[model samples]
Target: MKKLLIIAVMALSFGTYAQVDPTFEKEGDKVKATYFHANGEIAQQGYFLNEKLEGEWKMFNENGDKIAMGNYENGIKTGKWLFWEGDVQKEVNFDNNRIASVNNAKTKSPVVIN
Candidate 1:
């Protein structure tokens, strides 16, 4: 019975530590967002301007690996972005939220693998 009680307590503690829900905090007009993984790691974090995605945003996989990073303006994708898939890195350019160009580089750059 003592062993059972210890195990139950451990399980509950670990369970609470494993999963953390995402949180959004208001910062003036922008909303700061933070998303968490099942392992309680940060998955993505960024800010929303005027209720739209704005500024730089970073995305990570469940393993807490950065997979993609880019910027937004008024909820529209703009500028250059980088994405990672295994050993390859992809650079994408956006124009008015549309794909303007894409460049794939075979380099050993650590990136989030989604």
Candidate 2:
């Protein structure tokens, strides 16, 4: 029906612009940030120092599944980061904010297509 079509169009339009601001909380010397997706689900969670990204960060998909996790020092990437890709996991090492080495390992995990 025409009414059904109009309602569907409106829903899609709203979804296209469904942005929500991230919430921040103070924790000791760092500010904890929780970023959300359009559906109000947590997209990423991390800490910030001096208004810059600091410490460990975890990224999730819309379904609340972790897709990536890593660490940062004074906003610079550092340490090990894990990323899920299909049935494999990419383990990356960082030094000086750059890739130091990469190793691929097999794992059964849920994957989200962006």
Candidate 3:
């Protein structure tokens, strides 16, 4: 009896930990966003179409600043991607999962004197 009870408890615990959360997906007419995380901070966020990433996507830093933005088509990156670090910004051109060029500001753009 004790051995059977122990086996049941272990099965329950394993089942709980192995469960996977469902991702966002379009239902009928509305689109949804899904978040992937670690340590309670958002690691990735994007629209989900049929449980796959589709359309524009934005990634944020732990402090919540916009870190990167790009377009996604059928869960694959398409078009251009922009990345930023502090005052520096870089633009990367992408073609069919390949990076074509990267342009970075050699010197910071001057503030507009209004």
Q: Tell me the whole-model lDDT of each prediction, alpha carbons only.
A: 0.91, 0.92, 0.73
Residues 24-113, model 1: lDDT tens digits:
999888999999987777899999998899899999998878899999999999999999886689999999999999999888954787
Cα-based TM-score, every candidate: 0.73, 0.80, 0.62
Which candidate model has the greater TM-score, 1 or 3? 1
Rank by lDDT, descending? Answer: 2, 1, 3
Tell me the tens digit of each residue's lDDT in model 3 across 47-87.
Answer: 76765677788887867777899988777778889898987
Among residues 3 or more apart in sequence or in different chains, the pairs in candidate 1 whose N, CA or C atoms overlap within 3 Å are 66-112, 67-112
RMSD of 1: 6.9
**What is the per-residue lDDT of model 2 for residues 1-28, given as tens digits with 9 covering 90 to 100?**
9999999999999989889999999999
Per-model root-mean-square deviation over C-alphas: 6.9, 6.6, 6.7
Number of the candidate with higher TM-score, 2 or 3? 2
Model 1 lDDT, residue 51, Cα? 84
Residues forming the 10-long window of minimal summed lDDT in candidate 2: 105-114
Candidate 3 clash pair list: none
- Candidate 2 regions with alpha-carbon error over 4 angstroms: 1-12, 109-114
